[model samples]
Target chain A: MNAEDAGANLAREADESHGRTVAAERRALVQALILVLLTLWTFRDEVTKSVAQASTMTQAAHGLALPALAVMLLYCRRAELSRDLQKGSWWGAVLIILAVLAYAVTTWPFYVSYVRKLQFVTAFAGIALVVGGWRILWRCGPLLVLTGLAMPIGWNTYSTLSIRPETLTMDTALKALNLLPDMVVRLQGTELHYVHAGVQGVVGLGDAHNGLAAPLALASVYVFVTFSRVRPAWQSAILLIVAIPVVALGNLLRVLLHACLTVWSGAMPAEGLPRDVALVLSLVATYLVVAAASIVLDHLFVEEGGDSRVATTIRR
Target chain B: MESKDIVRTGAIRRLCSPIFGTTALILLVAAVALDPAMTALDIHFRKTSILPRVSLSAFDAATLPSFKSAPKESPFLDPHPDDDAGTRDHVLQRLQERDANGTDGQVILFVTYYSDPNDQVPHTPEVCYRQIGGVVRAIGSRTVELGQGDWPKRVEVRTVIVEQELANAAIAYVFCANGRFYTRRNEVRLALGWPGDKRVYFSKIEAVSRFERDEQPDLAMARACKLLSEVLPALLTRHFPRQADLKHRAVGAAR
Candidate 1:
């Protein structure tokens, strides 16, 4: 197979059931989208009334991020989805009618006091559309259903960052600060207020107040980018999990350094010689550092899964 | 995007009907109709956990409190022994009407905003707009500290009731000082100043909630007296010393 064939094969080999499922999803999305519009148009009175009292409504129906991600997942699976689009069941109208009725009933101020679990209706509709679309249409679009899970799916994790790396971040950074000649550092909480008694505070600078979030966020983004390339589902998941701490530690250290610089310079003498400016530039520097680190770590860990379907795909 | 280049598809499409297509289209329409208005609702009550304890638990029918704009100063104080301004006595007299009318509690939280002329070091014409504004917002009142609220002598002791829900609802005080929330009570003093300023230093604690009013009588009284001690100075400072003399003393002492 040529490069194009190989790329298609990788996607084709994802899982037969998943491939067919995504192909059939298009009609459903279009159907659902249309059904929603019709129900809304038919019941314009209810929709209008809710707008008048929108400020005091019960249950938030809008979570843009989750729906947007779901839509994207559907789009990614568009390659295999168009074929199976016809095989899906059609309870779309019934759901549309039910959701509108639920919405209309919930609009009354008294419904807010009722024990109807008021938010349940819209949540059910959103889930139905996403999961149903995913099952009927096998594209990544349905995977966006998982994004909504973010609300209730928090978990305790093991990571160096979670292990209270604030101490380690500060200790390593402060040790580096102490090595400098004639530098007096005073740490108040996370702030390292340094007073310089050397050379009329010669115009100079060092990493005292570098922000910590940038390094951590960059590390996370880097690991994600690496995982998408070599493509091991398990390694990708593990790395994604581990990268949280790596990035978090990087961020804590950055903030520590950011505060340290303030002490180093008695006052914000110059705009460029400030922590705020460092924050802007540190983005690129950190991305480079994090990307390099992940590339190295990813290569070190990537094993030939000869028995695994994922490993065989890469060999081709 | 063609049918012949097919890899795989979901079983629902193969197992389901063209009629479901209509249903899918219908639900899509419903989702569109429902989501727009639903998304528009904005709830700020959720921002503060303490608000529910105070306002939420209050009988829903409880309307806004009856307030007659008492003149800016507390009317309880005996007339200033001797003063050029004459207005200090006038300001103190106003609080008497509310007291005489038998309003069970008179608790006024004010945010005075001005550079203290008497502040040592002259602190560079410092400003506390955010800090003051934050306090004003937090307490759900409005105040402008331009002229006479800092005079300490204006403070007086009032009754205290500790177990009040509204009183305890004063849990988190947020102020943006130097672009940071000065959240703690000790931190509040840096910008709030001591009672010496004409207004209540932190004086006059009334049990705003029924629970606290009934539960901790002594603690409430102590808190009320403590509040009066702190607040009266700040309020009086605003008027007695007046801005001109106060600035001279503060700036001059530094010099």
Candidate 2:
């Protein structure tokens, strides 16, 4: 090949490389600016108060861990995200506009309430769409949404919204207590009075036993994690479907265990080593339930057949 | 390019594309709808919870009691006193009143109200008091019959003896909805039901009286209850709105 022709080709290549570098730099700058704005918006008064006083330490801890988990998930799926950058659709602008509108509406006096953080999620998703496009959203939507878990919601809010399910939980716990030999359970509201051998024990299922919020928060993250890992569409769907029950069963176990402890120890103290023990026990029970449900889901759905090698591995 | 063309041809993409944004929007709406917070109906109650507008013109400060509101200097004093600000907001009105009427220590009155069934009613002192740097020694609930009204209400008050490091205190609190009284927080909540528009406006009259370390916890509780019985009735008449009162006032105004 001639030297002149080779030099011309090299100059064209350099120009192309410079153009790509400039585009990447611009993208990075835009992302940084968006992050700065989001940070300013998110750490406002209401959100700060909520985060500072997250309902429970367990919740706070999980919430704190969510960002890291999301990052890890993103890193794990970097290949997919990299491949997805082939095109940036105009629909991203639509998402950004919708999210900004939502954020604006939520900021209004009457609209700023329990679920205000959801708008922040919407906004972040919008930013992702604007920056990385629809495929980025489809790939990273759950992770972006994972940031919502960081927003604090009190368990009492659950009691107000999901009173029926909580009442059911309390009732089921009462029934379980009654089924225990020599344990007579009487219910008044969410309180269960256990009378056995002249010892009367009263356990009031307060906001802590509201039954939905904690489990829902935990299961949402778990399902997101499961989805990030498991590729099979139907299996992930099954896991998603089972999350509620798995969480509910764990909560039920907590209530029943607390009742048993009350029956044995007499008068559940409000705050002490005993209360802490019960909380830890409840968490353990919840994780165990989740694990068991996951195994069952994997065996029944993901593995195809009961006697299959996959099912055997799942069983083991 | 069209959304379909840009969206990758995959099972997950196919599943999510049509419904994901819609689902998220629905989820947000459902949360706001089912949620007990930030709705138009509850906004009035939410505002009231923060700063209840009870006309205190009738309350003659000189004749009734020589009580000075707790000084702003108290370190342990909470700016937002309620356990859950998201639920109750400013409804849980707290006052640290220094009494000149021969009471040994200050009287702390924590008045909490919930008009929405979705609103947060006050919990037992064991749960509320014990969490805020107080060690609870004994907790009990009993019905205390107060006043000779058309409906002779037997109000259930939970008495608690909280042992703080600097001092010890006894607290007696009762949960009441409209004119009706409930023995427990759960009972009040159950009575309220799950509605954006609440049927009853509930309030908890919590009275706290501190004492010397030597004073018996039971004695402190009795004094606290006495102080509560005095303050609560008047506060209830002033602060918490009643449907019956509204009806009665409407009738009187018509005449």
Candidate 3:
């Protein structure tokens, strides 16, 4: 064959090979997408129910915000994720298998809403792994993880985690108020009793007022969403570590103010401000504390070498 | 377009292969099969009350039964107003009856119905009692026989023994959903969670009565059930569809 003809043949062969690679990539993407879509569609009822419950229930208000935030974060990171796609993992098959088994188990309907959603998320993660391998999972996993907030951590769990911490916060509030003259404060479980100038002020730190669940939930969302932006392992760790105290302190402040109001007003009117309005007031205080803490943390943990430590740690 | 030709395509064939394709098909079927039919039971009707006033001889014999409508002003503050703000709020009827026997017997019958399965049955008396400044000490469940004879009807109820300072009382309530009566919370949840189960109108019939501190909740519940039983059949027939009552009763009567 002539030299020019041979070169043309080689060029055609290279073009064909590239086309084949692109086709393969497309196939994998389609497979992954379809699997995830089907899994979500199958569990839409569970998802809807959990969302509805979360929206209605005061304590689980985080459930509604989480998925939406996660979606936004995912959208923000889409470019980076697509740029960082990696080859499929054999280990991903193991995840897919486990997820399938979980899918089957969750079908029984005996599991609570959160457990079912947890399983569904696991299956989605497994599908992602099988489709795009480990890199895609690590890059995109946080968004999937955030979807978990859509499911409420069961009421029993909420109660267990809330009661002690709230009681502690109330105790701390009483101690802080002890310095103030003409105020007598006593705490019984989650109930607060105050007698100032013979005016009895009683406030109960209920599930909504517990101040534990919302802060933890909000903090987790903050950390996970900012996982990409925050630098170093220690900063994210510090953010998580400080979340409880910030939340507790905010709650303490709110309760103290509320008690003071009760003492001054003799009592909140029988109907009082709605429970939800009160919860929002506390949450506003919590947001301020969290925001201030986040600022200080951001300054302290300035990104080094433009790399996230958790991402690096996962790689290792 | 031939079946063999389609089967020869590697992608289609691989997906349709015994393991993956079969598994997918089975799972899809299982998901559909297991999906709760009542996840969002939708019934569209705008009315004040689903249940008619059930005035019985016994209720009248004890003392003339007095019917009082739930207050309309500031429904959010009221215990349960008929004009609840929640669009999905269950249709509720609250009537307070005084015992005519001069024994100072007072009973409050609170009837609630849900047209949407997603609209949950209201918080049980355990929660309701607590919300209303009462301390609940003991909670239990029991089945009460309402009718006599070969085909005797029975109603299951949850009893909450409550104490508010000097006043002592018992709250006995039954939740009838999809035609099945559930006294306990878990039973109702399980039935509602069951995959593809049809959603139907369900009612929460709650009767609250004053009881002596020494009286057992069982006795109070039995009395409540007897009083409730007088109107239950007629109420169920009027409010719930015949099929829901018949099918659920047939399947769950033994339980």
Per-residue lDDT of model 2, residues A52-119, tens digit only: 65544444445666656766887676656655653344455455456545544454432444455665
**Per-candidate RMSD vs. true structure?**
18.6, 15.7, 11.4
- Model 3 sits at a Cα RMSD from the real structure of 11.4
Model 2 ranges with Cα > 4 A deviation: A1-43, A55-61, A154-157, A208-211, A267-269, A272-282, A285-316, B1-255
Give me the candidate number with maximum TM-score: 3
In model 1, how large is the Cα lDDT of residue A296? Answer: 59
What is candidate 1's lDDT per residue for A143-184, written digit by digit as tens?
322322212110111111122344345545666666767776
Clash count list over all predictions: 122, 4, 5
TM per candidate, chain B: 0.20, 0.59, 0.56
Better of 1 and 2 by TM-score: 2
CA-lDDT, candidates in order:
0.35, 0.56, 0.56
Badly placed stretches (over 4 Å) of model 1 are: A1-179, A187-192, A197-227, A256-311, B1-255
What is the docking quality class of candidate 3? incorrect
- The residue-level lDDT of candidate 1 at B188 comes to 36
